[model samples]
Target chain A: EPEVTQTPSHQVTQMGQEVILRCVPISNHLYFYWYRQILGQKVEFLVSFYNNEISEKSEIFDDQFSVERPDGSNFTLKIRSTKLEDSAMYFCASSEQTDTQYFGPGTRLTVL
Target chain B: AQSVAQPEDQVNVAEGNPLTVKCTYSVSGNPYLFWYVQYPNRGLQFLLKYITGDNLVKGSYGFEAEFNKSQTSFHLKKPSALVSDSALYFCAVSTHASGGSYIPTFGRGTSLIVHP
Candidate 1:
């Protein structure tokens, strides 16, 4: 089965540096999403992308966060200025036409 | 806003025994419920979902979930527990009210431990 793939399984960056998490969703999937889970916390939605634009975003997806589909298969989430609280496991997910989403292994972001 | 509730923080079961992970949901319109499992250091794996038809939905790794609209529940079940099944489980719900969006509102995960 085809699965969503993410690069840089683990990312470590300085507190004030910029970080970009990359994901390659399923080739045929139309809807892509970003979610994060703080250690020992529930997974929280960050943003959803479709048709090369953001469909919806949560409060956590503030000014520092931006998502771009730079290519057909690559979906990138960029954080302008990383904060300590931004350290979490970021996940990328995609779906064909249903609510059933397939998630990537996730990228663990650690801010120093 | 649609929401999901996983009442239990943890559930312990013995190997070879049946196990259940309960999930309840609140949605304004038709509910699209799902169950996902996560192993340590990994992402959430899709377990199963309930869209519109039958209430019982079977998914990967011998997992199944039953959707009860009257009670607003979508509980996941496995007939037999395995040590490999020990992991964190999450329940999620989406509604048509959100423009058929696939974004799911997830509940706090429940950790399941199967003791041998």
Candidate 2:
């Protein structure tokens, strides 16, 4: 079965630096989403992207966060001026329609 | 908006015994419920889903969930538990919004520990 794949399984960055987490969703999937989970917290939705535009975002998804589907296959989430609290496991998910999302392995972002 | 609640933080079951993880939801309209499992340091894996029709939905790995409309619950159950099934399980509910997108809301998660 086709699955979502993310790059650089682990990322370490300085608090003031920028970080980009990349993911390649299933080949034919349309809707894409980004979610994060703190070490021992619930998985929180960051943003959802469809038709190359942000469909919806959570309050946690502030100005520092942005998502882009630069190409047909690559979808990326970028965080600028990361804070200490940004340390978490970021997951990428995709679905053909609006239901049943398939998730990627996730990238552990460590903002020191 | 849709919300999911997993009442138990952890559940312990002896191997070969049946196990059930409780999950309830509150939604304005119809709910699309899903069950996912996560192993240590791994991403969430889809176990099963309940959209409409059929009160009982069977899923992956000898697991099944019964959808109780009156109770507003979709609980995950396994007939026979195994040590390999020990992991963190999450229940999510998706509700369609005006924009025609079904955004999912996840519960805190339930930890299942199967003793051999």
Candidate 3:
């Protein structure tokens, strides 16, 4: 089965530095999403993208976060300035229609 | 807002015994419920979902979920337990939100440990 794929399984960056997490969602899926889980916490939604625009975002997705489908397959989440609290496992997910979503292995971001 | 509740922090079961991971949800409209399992160092894998179904939904790895609208719950069950099934399980509820999308809210995960 085809699955979502993410790059840089682990990322370590200095505080206040810019970082981008990349994901290649299932090729045929039309909707994409970003979520994060701080260690020992529930997975939180960050943002969703469809039709080349943001569909919705959570309060946690503040001024610092931005997502873009730079290419047909690549969906990228960029954090303008990282904070310690931003350290978490970031996951990318996609769905063929709107019901079931397939997730990627996730990228563990550690902001020092 | 749609929300999911996984009351138990962890569940322990013996090998060959049946296992159940509980999940409850709150949603304004009809809910789209899902269960996902995460093995250590891996991503969340879709176990099953409850859309407009016959209440009993079967999924991958011999797993199944029963959606109870009256109780507003969707719980995952398996007839037999395996050590390999030990992992972090999450329950989520999705509802229509702004931007013409259905956003999911996840509950704090429940850890399942199967003892041999």
Candidate 4:
């Protein structure tokens, strides 16, 4: 079973620094998404990417957030300026056509 | 907007017993429901989904969920609980009217604890 893979399982960054979280979705998936979960909170949708463009985004995905395909295999999320509240577990997910999404192990970001 | 409600914060069950995690949903059109499980420090794992057709949907890890259209509910059930089954479970919903571009709305999640 092919699974979505993410790099830098855990990251620690300064409050004002920029951070990039990378993900490689399933080889044949056409739709990709990013979600985040604050500690003890529900997983929140950040953005969705298709055809190398953002399809939809949530309020949490404000000016500081951007997503890029960059390459055929790599999808990344970048935060221009991190805040303490930005610390959370970020997940990348993919799907073929159905709504059933397969998720990666996630990247834990810690800001101090 | 599509939304999901997981009323219970946590559910405790004994090993070898049946366990259920409740989920209710609200959507404008026909709803597509899903259940996912997350272990500590890991991402969400797809458990099962109900798109159309049969109300009973079977999924990985010996889990199943029944979709009740009348109640707008999809609840996950496992016949026998294992210690490994202890994890955080989430319920999600999306509507077909969104033209497949809609992002799923998730619930607050329910923690399941299986005691031996």
DockQ of every candidate? 0.68, 0.72, 0.83, 0.67
**TM-score, structure 4 vs. true:** 0.96
Q: Which sections of candidate 4 miss by over 4 Å?
A: B97-99
Error of 4 at B86 (Å): 1.1
lDDT of model 2, residue B8: 98
lDDT of 2 by residue, B26-106 (tens): 998889999999999788999999999998999999999999999999999999999999999999998875555677899
lDDT of 3 at A29: 97
Cα lDDT of model 2 by residue, A1-112, tens digit = 9999998799999999999999999999999999999988899988888888888888999999999999999999999899999999999999898988999999999999
Clashing pairs in 1: none
**Clashing pairs in model 2?**
none
Candidate 1 runs further than 4 Å off = B97-100
For each candidate, what is the lDDT? 0.91, 0.94, 0.94, 0.92
Best by DockQ: 3
Task: Provide C-alpha RMSD values for all models, in order.
Answer: 1.3, 1.0, 0.8, 1.3
Model 4, B1-116: lDDT tens digits are 88899999999999999999999999988888999999987889999988889999999999999999999899999999999999999999986433356579999999999999
Model 3 chain A: which ten-residue window has the lowest total lDDT?
A94-103
> With candidate 2 superimposed using the best TM-score fit, by how many Å does residue A106's alpha carbon deviate from the native?
0.7
Model 3, residue A9: C-alpha shift (Å): 0.7
Q: Candidate 1, residues A1-112: lDDT per residue as tens digits?
A: 8999998899999999999999999999998999999988889989888788887788899999999999888999999999999999999999887477899999999999
TM-scores for the candidates: 0.96, 0.97, 0.98, 0.96
